[model samples]
Target: MKKSDVLEQIRKIGLVPVLRAESESQALALAGAIADGGVTCMEVTMTVPGALKVMARLAKERPEILLGAGTVLDAETAKECVGEGATFIVSPAFDEKTVSYCRAHEIAVLPGALTPTEVIRAWDAGADVVKIFPASAMGGAKYLKSLKAPLPNIEMIPTGGVSLATAHEFLDAGAYALGVGADLVDTKAIRGGHPETVTAHARKYMEIVKGFQAGCLI
Candidate 1:
């Protein structure tokens, strides 16, 4: 998909399920479960043993879903995932090379940032979206609300501490999107053969996103 189109989809969904799994099968299965719950976008972290292949397989098999590579620390890994059909790339920290490579490839890149300086630097480096990671430790939604005053146009996605209960607060605080991991896709539940649990969690989160988009939660 075109870069703008992919970003628009993300903005509309407002929640990106970040998955860390024991195996590619688990990741893909969890992805499918989330998809079944109406969330078609996901970030498969490189922490997974074969993350590149996992992204490739999901992109190929779940053509309707948008797949991205996460924990992408460098340009080479970013390029590899894109070559393998990842529609987007995300990193825990901002890297100029990684941002540049994704821009060069016309893929969406969300490089993690914590401070105002890092956020602007990532934006200046051509990040499609800035991920405010470890967000809770940094003050979560309230902190993000403060950033919007001066950086109104910069789209910020706060990850690492978002949950179904707090999803609406982030959206109300002006998060362009949210990156949720364990809270949305519990690794233990998946490992214990409870894909349904993850699916149900996804459904609730999407409901909040939908409500926010419709201005029902404000």
Candidate 2:
């Protein structure tokens, strides 16, 4: 997908399920389940074993899904993930070199930032979006609201501590989108052969997103 289009889809869905699995096969199963639940976008964190292989398989087999890589730490790792078919890259810390490389390659990149300074720095370096990592630690949606006040032009995706209960709050706080893990991916559910749990969470979150965007909810 085109870089801009990828970003558009992300905001439209309003959720990116952060899939981190213990095994490649489990990761694929969980990702496939999420897609089946009607949310086709996911960030497969590099922490998963054989993550690149998982990305390659999904890219080739599930071309319709918007698959990306997460937990990318450096330029070299970012390059390798993109080569393996990651349409986007997410890092826990902002690395100018990686951000610049993604900008040059036309791949969407969401580099992590905690403070307003880091957020702007990443944006200036060409990040498509600044991921506020460990977001809840710094105050979750309330913190995001504070950042949005002055940095209204910058897009922020609040990761960590995002759940169905708080997804609406995040969007209401002006988050571009949310990078959700346990609440949506639910590792234990997947491990127990209950992908249904993942799907249920996706469906519920999607409904909330739709409601929020339509202004049907506060």
Candidate 2: segments with Cα more than 4 A from true spot: 216-218
Report how far off residue 45 is in candidate 1 (Å): 0.5
> 3 in model 2: Cα distance from truth in Å?
0.9
Residue 187, model 2, lDDT: 80
Q: 17-57, model 1: which lDDT tens digit per residue? A: 88898888888888899998899898999999888888888
Tens-place lDDT per residue, model 2, 1-218, is: 79999999998888888999989989998998888888888999999999999999999998878888999999899999999999899999999999988988899999999999999999998999999998999999999999999999999999988998899899989999889998888788888989998888788988888888888445
lDDT for every model? 0.89, 0.91
Report residue 27 deviation for candidate 1 (angstroms).
0.9
Could you report the Cα RMSD, in angstroms, for every candidate shown? 1.4, 1.5
Mark the regions of model 1 whose C-alpha exceeds 4 Å error after superposition: 216-218
Predicted structure with the largest lDDT when compared to the true one:
2
Q: Pairs clashing in candidate 1?
A: none
